[model samples]
Target chain A: MTGYTAKKAGYAIEYIALIAVVLIVWCVMAGRGTLNEIIMPAPSKVLDTVTELIGSGVLWTNLVISVVRVLKGYFIAVVLGVSLGILIGLSKHAERLSVLIIQIIKPIPPIAWIPLVILWFGIGESGKVFLIFLGSFFNILINVHDGIKQADEKYIEVSKSMETPFFKHIFRLIIPGAAPNIFTGLRIGLSSGWMCVVAAELVSSTTGLGYMIMNARQFGQTDVVIVGMLTIGIIGKLMDSLLRAVEKRAIKWNWSE
Target chain B: MEHKYIEIKGLSKIFTRKKESVHALENIDFSVDRGELVCILGPSGCGKSTLLRAICGLDTEHSGDVFIDGRKVIKPEKTRGMVFQEHRLFPWLTVEENVAFALNGVDKDTKAELVQQHIDLVGLTGFEKSYPRQLSGGMAQRAGIARALVNDPELLLLDEPFGALDTFTKMAMQKELKQIRKKSNTTMIMVTHDIDEAVFLADRIIVMSPRPGSIVKVIDVDLAEPRDRNSYEFLEIRKEVFNEF
Candidate 1:
């Protein structure tokens, strides 16, 4: 137990060391006037801006909006992606019919769809949600499809020998077999969704961290911009950590090594 | 005429890969009596595994008929159970869950009771909640056995089930398998490369040769219970089997 705790402490130190060094360098550079305050603000100034935003309730409001958008889009992507993935994965006919279209659309970046999305849905919540969905959907679909396709033939045989019912076979063998890959998809899809929401906000929005960063930049409030960027980073990490925690519990068998 | 419990007539498997066709098994004929432990012993690449798969109805492309208990084998059924060389236990499930994998339609209490009985049968009672990865190779294979037996299969097909274990563990598993067979009275067909394993476990050994696998010999083991490996009759039988190779 002590050894485990020590190892955890070691990791914590490693994580903090780089951030501390970067912060010290930023403080020194800004204090010495070696860096332009307009372009790169001191760590202390960014911290002060964070305090100001939090005090005014601006941070919480925008954070909630961005989080809601991400959740909405991510939920849709997961439901559709997993269902479609299983469909395609199980049926060769479905795979053959959809493969070419999926391949053609997959390579195109979500940012490339911004103009088309704006034209279709305008600069409203729908447009942003649509953009986020596009960004996350393909990642999830491909991963889930791959997961199902890679379901162990041996396990399938076991289920077959048992004469497992159709739905039981799918739920017990195929889905669980594809779980690790599905989790991978969810993680990547989530990160991509987060990125899409920020990009959409940046392109056309009056709220969200991306808008805050852009607005702050126009006024040369580099501290607020930095604060916005930091908020995005911190929130992204937190969300990923939350996912990882759930993953650890869901697939504890995978973590034996 | 007394019908055999399991019969394989003129079984042949040809694999058509790309442009070339390879003969895997050729005109394999065999019959296993009810509650008999039969082992198909052969060298590697002799299609013994393929033969087991055919009997298990996992391979339907073979050109022949396998009748089990007067019914024609079409596809896999709950009455037929198979254990592969690898434990092949689902890594996501605990030992208890793995054992209970095939008991889907049973009520919760019955399922749990059956799972508990099989776990105890396999000497894995204490480690029911442990995942496959957490168990040793032998333990995992025991769980695989438990899983196969959970459905009360009338026929159990094992393809090199203990071929991956160390010699000592293999011997111990062989003994455990004998006890299991005695208790269940289920007809068993095991494929193995180990001659001693066949000699120890099989009521009759069907030895095969590679390059389009075909049965070369049918040797009945008339030895009594707890057959000793070092005994004179055992060595004589072992030598006879080895000489056939």
Candidate 2:
């Protein structure tokens, strides 16, 4: 039961800094002039923007669209990453072929290909998803590759000594044995997928939180910008928490061992 | 013995690494009789482990064949079970699951029964649900034994199984092994450096020579069952095995 004790330092410092910043902003703005709509919309107004967007169903629709893009891009990345990872991780030939190619491609920013994506996929959901895929694919591929490469040789020896059949050995022993590393890849891929989605929407969509921020900038709706930013941060943090929870539950059996 | 369960004839293993050939085991001929407990004892680097590993078909480049009941063993199978020096239980699996791993294709009812039977046989009935990390070293080794014995192998091969345990635990396990062998009558081969352990557990002990290991001597234990370890005869035999060192 006591395993759930929260770490005090990181969260406490972050919360304290945020609170101090908000208090300073509020005090300075209130003392400087009467409450106004334009110059620095009160923090309360930003929160009100969130509720209004939620009540009107605008928030839900845009959130779903962004989520769908992340899912499609991330799912494709996982399939490609796992297969490629296993290949490169297991075989010297595959690793040699990919080592240089991955290095060349990995350093290029996913957003830098926005112009190329626009030319190929155009201004649609496809363009946004492709961008997201570029961001997430390499992260997953590298982790999966590392996992497979480092699988315990002793276990493999054991299975080989038993004459464990080929397919069963690969599927039951190799894959699951490398699962912890695969999970690390998954968490990295999913989070980076979100970063790509935001950049994708900014380049293409008229909907999503990224588009909302762009629109708010045009109309000088500073409060809406804050709401959009907060939504992105909160959702990213929540998704990370969800992934950690799933990982813990899945690996609990290993705790004793 | 004419009724030997296993016969290793003219066995030799060499490893070619970077075009440099290393002789691991020389042309060796040794045999084990049915229902006998045999131990291979030698100093470090004498290839005691290499010879044992070759018998289990762990060495692909080895010459000669290991025959069990008139059949050659080209690879490991349910007929031959092996226990390693480090109780290699899968951390992700519980005791029951680890024991059942070898019977991957067995029917569900039979699998369940065999798993439970082996767990009890190893004196780990209450710890079936525990993982390898949760158990003490002795308990984990017992579980490893259960996993090896679950399939009812014709022969059991142990590679320094109790070398990692403390003296007290090792002695207790030695007694347990004797009891289990008496009840099951399974032919057993063990590799160890302990002279006392060899005398206490083995019906015969094969001592190996230096590099390109071959059998130097095979000492027979003529002492009767439930043999007194403190007796002068037992100590004498134990000393003879140690003298080979």
The local distance difference test score of each candidate is: 0.90, 0.83
Residue-level lDDT tens digits of model 2 in A97-139? 8899999999998888989989998898888888888888999
* Model 1 C-alpha lDDT versus the unseen true structure: 0.90
Considering summed lDDT, which 10 consecutive residues are worst modelled in model 1 chain A?
A: A195-204
B76-132 in candidate 1: lDDT tens per residue? 888888998999999988999888888978999999999999999999989999999
Q: A1-257, model 1: which lDDT tens digit per residue?
A: 69999999999999999989988888888889888777777777788888999999998888888989988999999999989998999999999999999999988887888889888988889888888888889999999999999999989888888888999889978999898999999999998899887777855899987788788889988888778887888888888899988988898888966
The local distance difference test score of model 2 is 0.83
Q: Which stretches of candidate 1 lie over 4 Å from their true place?
A: A1-9, B17-20
Top of the candidates by TM-score:
1
Work out how many backbone clashes candidate 1 has.
0
Residue pairs in collision within model 2:
none
TM-score of 2: 0.86
Off by over 4 Å in 2: A1-61, A83-103, A219-223, B1-4, B14-23, B63-65, B70-72, B209-212
The positional error of residue A111 in candidate 2, measured at the CA in angstroms, is 1.4
